[model samples]
Target: MHVLELAKRRKTVRKFLPDKPPKEDILKAIKAAKEAPSGMNAQPWKFVVVDDNWLKAKIREACEREEEKFYSHTKGELIAWLNAKGFKPEKPFLSEAPYLILVFGHTKAPYWLHSTWIAVGYLLLALEELGLGTVTYTPPNPKPIKELLRVPNEWKLQTILPVGYPADPKPKYERKKLEDVVSFNEF
Candidate 1:
């Protein structure tokens, strides 16, 4: 798929098919993440792929609590906005999707906090090209995510992404046009 088309189709997928994607496919996503540019070439990123049922349950439990708050406890328009984006309290996709990709951004990397996010963008775009669906989540108790997954202290949980074949192709969400988002030579 062309880069532009793949990007256009990519979104936070909340529903997944029953099928699991192959390891190689998952690796392809990692490859892109690894290839992402980092500060001073430190490449301060590590990916922990979790599929164990017990572990997934724990992460899901943490996120579910967060999601519940996001829906019911969150104020006015935020709730509707979240719903429009396909985020809901019931994230059944956590169990349905076989692979839980945990992106770790290392704090030890001397200079680039933003580079970690660049790597995530690369991974997400790459996964979309591979005909898989991915949903990025901020797991509660990020410290425990590493412990639950047994990742090192140097690395921090940047985000948790669920990966699998998509259950449906959702319509593209509205986006601000480039002109609207951009300021020509200066702000």
Candidate 2:
């Protein structure tokens, strides 16, 4: 598909089919993510791909615990924003999706966070191109995740991604125009 068409068609999918995606496709996306440039050639990103049902359930449980707290007390603009997206404390898709990619960053370097985020961007686009749907999520409490996944203390959880085929049609969301977002050399 053309780049522009792909860009226009891609959407953030939360509801996913139970079907497992091809491993080759997942690896391709990760390869693309790793191609992203990093500071001083230091590739400081690690990913944990979870496809097991039991493990996914554990992750969902942990995420829900954090989300429950966030939803009950969070109000005003943040609540309004979340409401617009139709988000709630329950995140069943975290387990429903066949793959959960746990993104991590090295604690040694501050620039690693930015590098990892750039890599994640590449991963998103690659997955979109491959017709796999994904959404980047963050659990309020990553402590359980660290313990459950046995992630080394040196690596910090950066994001959680649920990947699978979309269960429903993708929704087209409006975007800001270039003029609305861009500035001509001055803010």
Name the candidate that leads on TM-score.
2
CA-lDDT, candidates in order: 0.81, 0.89
Q: Would you give me the overall lDDT of model 1?
A: 0.81
lDDT of 2 by residue, 1-187 (tens): 7767777878888889878889889999999999988887688899889999999999999989989988999989999999997789999889999999999988786589889899998898889899998888988889899999888898999999999998757676789998999999899
- Cα deviation at 93, candidate 2, in Å, is 0.7
Task: Tell me the TM-score of model 2.
Answer: 0.94
lDDT of 1 at 153: 79
Model 1, which residues run further than 4 Å from truth?
66-73, 76-80, 83-87
Count of clashes, each model: 0, 0
Report residue 122 deviation for candidate 2 (angstroms): 0.3
